[model samples]
Target chain A: MVVNMINRVREQRPLIHHITNAVVMNFTANGLLAFGGSPIMANAKQEVADVTRLSQGLLLNIGTLHEDQVEAMILAGKAANEIGIPLVLDPVGAPATRYRSDACQRILQEVKPTVIKGNAGELAHLVNQDVETKGVDSTGEADHEAIVRLVAEKYQTGVVCTGEKDVGCMEDEVFVNETGHPYLAQITGSGCLLGSLLTASLTVEGNPEDHLMATLSHYGRAAEEAAAHPDVEGPGTFIPRFIDALAMEVET
Target chain B: MVVNMINRVREQRPLIHHITNAVVMNFTANGLLAFGGSPIMANAKQEVADVTRLSQGLLLNIGTLHEDQVEAMILAGKAANEIGIPLVLDPVGAPATRYRSDACQRILQEVKPTVIKGNAGELAHLVNQDVETKGVDSTGEADHEAIVRLVAEKYQTGVVCTGEKDVGCMEDEVFVNETGHPYLAQITGSGCLLGSLLTASLTVEGNPEDHLMATLSHYGRAAEEAAAHPDVEGPGTFIPRFIDALAMEVET
Candidate 1:
């Protein structure tokens, strides 16, 4: 099947609602826009549910977790579940703090997320595998496959573990795409941007696994192209070209 | 007098404490790093004052204003003032919401900021000028110089109004730099990044007027160079190159 997944996203224009952290909001929104998806960020406890109701997908990223934001996310997550729209959870730095851990647990318990996208360390934490993370950056090693599979079965949701290799698991079926650049991790919010891209892709009518792998392949291809650009000197120079590459047609 | 201001920033490496908005945190941090200045963002009310004490300057951005964030900003602003460190305020989207208007008022009333940075419309609101703003983008026109002057005099602080022409006012003295590209406004947080740049620049010894003008000129030069790059296609393509140009030593 010719699955032009991202192009379909451009045509369908799925609006993805994000209740993410402070650091990556602009990058995440811009990346989604570059990849042909609409992004909306609302963070008030009073109107989060209303915002989630209008969006095609909801992304709850617990990076800069605040008490007020957690409350808002719970409301939005519940609304997304009630509306029958797909929800994606990025439990960023869940192991770093008690509040983050509790917030993630509350989300996993109270919300029925369609997909969970995170780093190996974050997913490993979700599946009870020990992996050390400092702040939001994952620094420890883990069996990504085991973590994704275990978390996939436990949460009954698609799981994605992103690193040098990107792995996605949906129940018994697992997929891996190893086409990314090292530079993706060098800059902030690449993983969060991927969560947004995956959420936007999942909103399209297709197999979640297919969409996951496609999004990974597409993002990796874009990163590879951006890193290879002559004008890109370092991480700072690579970001804009990466966004441009996302907007361009690359072989996925 | 020969003034290599940015190189001085690299040599000094001021640790700038930011209690700014959510959307532009990553970009602002990365932009500062690329420009060879250190940026630290702390949000919790408990640690903001402590964090501000360690830094050379504090930035209070009311873009993604929250009640919790306002409290943190107030505490940090007060600490910076007491420590005799400079504070830069970006009253982002002040006219859009009543909460934001009130928040800006509270900061202005309670905090003794050294410099205030914003666009014509955003600055106009502070001096009680009726200029309409949509979200954060300035839609209406005003006397940029007049706005800067009024705000600077009223607050007894240096003021910068950024647009096609960046106007800086310190009491009776005024400086204007006409070197920035239009693409600077196309991306999110360019103004906020400018606020960070101005804050970093102000920390360097010499005239705040000279530093403000030099920083605007440098940023504008970077934007012009980035926009003129062969690889740039649009705003997405413009951002990375702009950052790279910030890293590159362009003549101010």
Candidate 2:
């Protein structure tokens, strides 16, 4: 099933619209291309609606949130909803500041996100649960299963809480994926790039839960392969190898 | 001189405040770290003045310019000037959009940029010289020498016009650096990353012309080394290797 889903993504080559943060734009764009998804990064208010309307999927991340981009995210999210395409939300840095927390909540209340993905801290903060978050990194531990289920049920959307062990919950059903490496934490935008992969995978017509699981597994496996490369001495060398591994089609 | 300049950067560990676009923030930050400089990316207008005041240098890039960020750029640029630190301006995509062009001009008029960097087309647009630029990429040829000299003399700032051959002009003297690879253009934010490196290098107490030349040379040399790696098949794999190469402190 995962193999078929992966193949479908490459076959369809869906265009994914992104209103993400500046920090991970290039990495996310390249990751989408590696995973066989076309990426259009248009965040300006004047054209986000048009761009989102033309895409097969939309991703909203609030890593570097500002007042104008928050408005653009709402505009793009509504447009994506109007077109009835899948939408993914990664509430990056939600626990760090009130502005970020408020913005994420606003986007959540306004747009019906098909999938909500973030670290334990971000997801926990979304539902009024406390978790230690420093800047954009999730520092404290939380019950991933409970948070995933709570967010999934509250928003009626698939929830992916990522860390050493990734838990994907859709409604009451939960899927656990243990396939990533610790080296991923050393690099910036590793979590943000996963949101991009999920956005692309959602373009495939399949079970939303399975799509999220497949993406998590694929990304984790790629990181493992990249970390194990002989030349990947540290995080710096692990990045490009990870990208190359993402481009490689692995069979289940 | 170049070796000392680079060593000074590592020894000083200058904190660079970046009001740059989202597309290359991760790469830019990672590249700055790799090159032995500290990077702080803060764009919120609420705290940009404080951030700029604390940093050794400032980088103002308009690749993903919006109304609020334009204000933050001006705010940060003015703060950098008040502190008497080196400030670099990269007019990314100036020729592509009216907003970008206007913002670049506004910043130039208000802040005395220490070094102004861009491609032939972007520099030409800043000086009212006609050159073809498609989006952010320079599509037509212009006299690099004339544009560099004109902009350098007009703004009384050092000018660096990057292309097949990079021309750095400071007043009557012009230095051409032919040290980059075609593969540098294959990756997004390569130019923006250069700006980050330049921002860090400018923090060194030296001739602005040598600092810009050293930055371009180091970046180009790293790209060449990254492209020559046997494991680098394409742009996907080139990124990590480039970061690793940048981390390798080679002799001048």
User: In model 2, which regions exceed 4 Å deviation?
Assistant: A22-26, A38-55, A64-69, A82-84, A96-98, A129-132, A140-150, A186-188, A203-206, A230-240, B1-17, B21-27, B33-58, B62-68, B77-240, B248-252
Per-residue error for A225 in candidate 1, Å, reads: 3.9
Q: Worst ten-residue run, lDDT, model 1 chain B?
A: B132-141
| lDDT by residue for model 2 (A154-219), tens | 899988999889999875779999999986876678888899889889888868778888889989
| C-alpha lDDT of all candidate models, in order | 0.85, 0.86
**List of clashing residue pairs for candidate 1:** B180-B220
- Candidate 1's clash total is 1
lDDT of 1 by residue, A1-252 (tens): 125787788787787888998788998878887887877676867557866876899999998888898888899999999999989999998878778888899878889898998987888888778887877778888788889988998898989988888888875789999988989989999999999998998888877778888889889998998999897899988888888888775344
lDDT of predicted model 2: 0.86
User: Can you give the lDDT of residue B165 in candidate 1?
Assistant: 83
- Tens-place lDDT per residue, model 1, B104-188, is 9998888999999888888998888988654456768777888888898889999988888888887578988899887675566
